[model samples]
Each structure stands twice: as C-alpha cells, then as structure tokens.
Target: MGKAASALDYRELARRRLPHFLFEYVDGGSYGEVTLRRNIADLEAVALRQRVLNNVSEIDLSTELFGQRIRLPVGLGPIGLAGLTARRGEVQAARAAEAAGVPFCLSTVSACPLAEVAAGVTKPFWFQLYMIRDRVFMRDLMQTARGLDCSALIFTVDMPVPGSRYRDQRSGLAGAPGVLGDMRRVWQALKRPSWAWDVGIHGRPHQLGNAVPVLGNDSGLNDYFAWMSSNFDPTVTWKDLDFIRSEWNGPLIIKGILDPEDAHDAARLGADGIIVSNHGGRQLDGVQSTAVALGPIAEAVGDQLTVMADGGVRSGLDVVRLLALGAKTVLLGRAWAYALGSDGQRGVAHLLQLIEAEMRVAMALTGTTRIADLDRSKLVSAEAGANNRAAALA
Candidate 1:
C-alpha cells in the first residue's frame, strides 16, 4: 500500500495482502530452516571492495543468457501456485518480466497453464520441469514447451519428495487437514476480502493447468498435492536426463545443483547451464546456501556451462555479490513472488527496476564497469581482513 523501497517492504505488504497459508507457503522453508537463514547470512557476510576516483559515468547491466541478451542479469525463478497469490499471478509476472526485458520461468505446477502463459506474453518464457514418475507426461510436457517456443528447459532435480515445511502444516496449506483445520483456513481467507474477491471468486479454474492432462481437470488442490507427492520420482538419476535431452533440443539447464561432482556431470551430460541452488532452502533444510556453494561449482564447470544461482537474493547488491562469487546470472524466487502477491505486475516491475538501479550504484561504487568484469577481485577476502586486523594490532 505504501512506498516499497526494497524487497522486504514488498514482503511485508505481501504478507498483509495474502492469506496466512499462502504467505507462509512463499516465506517458510523446510524443517529447521537452518539453510534458509544461512542463505541470507552468508550473502550478507560477503564484503565488496570499495573504490573511488574511477569514472563510473555509464554502467552496463546487459548480459547474454542462453544466447539472448537481457536487460539485467536477473531472472524470475519459478514459483508454483503463484496464481493463487493473485489474479492470474504467473501471467502478470510474465508480462512484467517481458516489459522489464528479463526472463520469467514458469513452474510445472503453475496455476496458469504453459499455453495460457505463452498466449498472455508476447515473447517466450522459460519453463521449469519436475521429473515425475510418468515418463509419458514428462515427454508430453517437453513437447508442449517446444510447441510454446519456450526458450529454455530448466530441469529441477532437488525434490525427490516434498520436504517437511512445518509452517505449511501449521497454516493448513500442505498436509491433509481435519474439519477444524479447514475451517481455520477458510476463516483466514475470509479475513482477506480483496484477496477473496480477486483470487478466490474471480480466479476460476483453480485446478493445476499443466497437470490437467495427467491428473484430470476435475482434480482439486488436495488431489494436485497428492499427485505431486506421489509422482516425484525418487529413482531419477543422471541417466534420466538422457531421456529429456532426447525429447528436447533447446538449451537445457539442470537446477538444484550444489556439489561440484553434480556440476561436472551436468556439463558432461551436455547441459547448457547449471543452477547452484538448494531449492531455495525449501527441499533441504541443512544444506549449503547457494552463495556458499556457488563459487566451487562455478569454478568447476563454469567454462563448460553457464553457472547461475538462486537463494537469498533480496537486493541488487546481493545479485552483484553472486556475480562476484562466480554466478553468471542470479534468479529471484520469493522476491518476485512477494512483489506479485503484494501488487501484482506493478510490484514485480518496480522490484526489477529497484534491483537494477541498486546494481548500477553498487557497480559504480565498486569501480566495476561491466558485468563480465566482476570477479573475486571485487570482493574482500576473509584472510585479507584477518591480516589487516593483525597488521593494525601490530
């Protein structure tokens, strides 16, 4: 409602605008959320070197991703059930991303179907896939993406099974609920009158669009969740990628990679890119943060594949921090979702502009002219800080 200067501001607004269950679904992480907290903490711990007297009149934020030049090095990562956040939220987000000159990735469980989103936006958006048990469904989805002229296929490999997000259970969004729990959820939704009108009443066909062919159009939210939990194939392995590659000839990116071995394997598997992520601390609680895991994975396979990351990217400074650490580009999951939940497409567009402006200021202050020029040199090492402290003591 008020001026949202940062992503946190939008987050607060989103929390107020959305129902408790939906807000918690976007905000909460799995189990203890140790990795979730660590994601932001480690990014804050990264110190950028400051420079002065360097000409920073013009700062270029443009970069090429999968051969297309984008306005910024940021992409809106996939978020499932985004349509529930607002009226056709995924379509709004895609339109905003298109207007911002960046890519918007649509989730497999998105509220808006891929074909619908494709029709909504002028340019093609990226598609994120979850490897379910049915190979037929997966192949059909790939063909659909190709038919929609999707730019990239981001294969998410982290969620073998859904993680235990206590907040979801508490908010009555995840697990099967009793009569009282359903009543409480209904009450919560009733409290948000504007949301109730926009998403609950007008936003019809609450069914998962993409899953309709496999799960049936008559399926409800509970059925969709049950299907997702039952279908995420635990037997998925590197060899499974061969099947995906055989079906689609577009740029393939393996998401949810934290280890160097996995990055190596992704490159060997002919993946065009690898996203260093821990599913935004949703799938795995105690795993390493993307910021902490990005450097090693990037160093290992960056030359062979595009190294990107996502987690705790709340600001443009965080984006620059990721780039300095070796991420060619960064993805924003909750940040954009928060904006979408708060103010629909306008919030997302403003957030993108805010991040881009912050990145330019950060680049100017850090004496970096081009995004490609960013490296470890722009960051102050811990060892260097320790040595400086010791020298000062002496």
Candidate 2:
C-alpha cells in the first residue's frame, strides 16, 4: 500500500487487501446499523471552536493513564481475530504501539495468545475480558493475565450474548450454514491470493490461542466460534463483579457503559475507570451513540472515576472532540485494525503518526497547548458546551 494520508485511506486499502468475509467482520455493525451511523454522525456534528494568535510551541501530548505515562491520549483498543489481518498481527500491532509509546489492548478471543504478545513487546499491555459461563476458565484467564504482567483488566459487560449482525450472516461470515454459502466464502478467500498466502497458507495455528486449553487440541476456527456462541454467561449481573475484583488486584476498568446509572455503578463497584462505548456499534442497534452518552455519564461519575470513550473515532480532531466533551483519553478500534490489515506493522505506525500530527494542528487551532486544557470552552456549539457544563453541575 502507498502512503495513507488518513484513516479512510487505510480503510480503503484494507478493503482491497482483505477478503469480503474478513472485511465485513471488522466493518459491519449489528442490525439496521442505526447506532453505527449515529456514532459517526453525532461525533461529526460536534463543532470545535477556533482561536487565533495563541502560542502553540512545545506542545506536550503525553498524559498519564493508570499511572503510566503514554506518548498520546490514545491507545489501540482490543480487537478479535487481529492475527488473521496479517501474520502474527496482534504482536505486530503491540510492537507498533510500544514503538509509538502507547498501549495495545488484547482481546479474550485474540488469534494470537497473550504470552506470545507479551514476549514480543517491551511494555505491559492491557487485557479485555468477556465474562464466560465457566468460572474455572475465567479465573484461569485472570491468572494468565497476571502471569503475563498485564497492566489493567478491562471487564466487558455489554455482550451477555452476541448481537445480531445481519451483514455477517448475509456475507456468510457469521457461520451461516449452507453449501452455497460455504462455496461463496471459499471463492471470496480464493480471490485474495496475497491475503490467503500470508494469513491462510503461511499463518498456521489458526485456532483461538487463549481458548486452547478449554477447547482442547485440534480446535479450528469454527469450533472457536461455536464455543463463543455457547459460552458467554447470560446470567451475569452487577453482583458478579465481586468475583472478578477478588481475582484481579490491578487497576480495573468497566467497558460498555453508555448510561449514567451504569457509570455510577462502575464507580460504586470500586472501578478505577469506565469506558463509554457501545461496542463500536456492534451491539444494541438502536442505542444512543457513545458521543451522545459520554457527556452525561462523565458528568455523573467523572469526579469518582476516570472516563474514557471509543466509538466512530476516525481522526485526531475526533479525539479532541471527545476530550472536550469529558474523556480523559480515547481508544481506537477499527482505525489501527484497518492499518494492520492494509500494511501490517508499518501501516499502524503511519496511522499513529497521522493521528498525532492531526491532533497537534487541531490543538494549536483550538488554542489549547495541553490535553488537560481541553474542555467545553473549546466547543463551537453552545448546546454541546452547555450539555457538558450541565453534566458538571448535575
């Protein structure tokens, strides 16, 4: 791939490089995709105020999260099947994140195992967990994370059951059963010869690495998906968090919070942070966007816990918009995944550089010299600014 000027450029490259099934898996959302569209639209509708004649020399983009100093107020969010995007893709992304002085979060269903990724990178990365039905496996996973020296444990609370993503079903990507659908999937993979060679041919051990012990030997991709479909604990509730808290002694963050009540619950549970997200619009189709939900949640619990957000964040200016609304930092899900799918590690590095450069220009234009300086004052829309102020007052 040639040089990518923006995240969309890398997304286009990813579209060309990956097969239809794989691309749809990363790009599509659940049901009518109402929440998916709203996530981007609401973020774009947020206007930024412009200020002139302000000195912006020596801008410091570094910030502290969970007591670790990072290069930027952004981190690569957890992504499943990332290794299928390239050869050992999670390790490559983690290395790139470390090189860029940022954090890379590993998924519970990662194609690459945590031990391998931990061995490949210099710094400790974060781990995202999906509560499963088996307490033995869940506890073992936490022990494995602690053994790997994971910095934080992000407990995902939204997906009690997988959402209905019709695009995946239509594309034969979500294990649609039928000989014709199977043939179509095979044909699609055959068309992407380069991807097949790199990920299919050369990329051995296509099994879900972290789930190997429970799944036993000779488990394939289909078996992994089958396990996931049957294993997610639907009986989970707020009280179950005590089990996780007892097992993990590190900084804990509750992901998938989009309501003030949920945010307050996280804070009351002694969580160190709360991530305002809608699973990147992959869960609950008609729900509100993270951009719309973030302000109120932050206002309700910002004083008690750290607030972060992720959903339809495509650029550095979007990062600024999120911070102006109340997030201390933001996470990128599809942004870095697209880069990795397009050009592997180099693509992720370039994307990070592009976002950082964009953020610097945005901060200078908005008359802010530090990440801490961003607030409702920098918002161009009076209503948007007022919403945040009301959140604070409430």
Stretches > 4 Å off in candidate 1: 178-181, 389-394
Taking all chains together, the TM-score of candidate 1 against the true structure is: 0.98
- Can you give the lDDT of residue 85 in candidate 1? 89
Error of 1 at 295 (Å): 0.8
* Model 2 RMSD vs true structure: 3.9
Report the error of model 1 at residue 363, Å: 0.3
| Structure candidate 1, residue pairs in collision | none
Instruction: Determine the backbone clash count of candidate 2.
Output: 0
Which residue pairs show backbone clashes in model 2?
none
lDDT digits (tens) for residues 223-246 of candidate 1 = 767887799999999999989999
> For model 2, what is the alpha-carbon lDDT of residue 347?
94
Per-model root-mean-square deviation over C-alphas = 1.3, 3.9
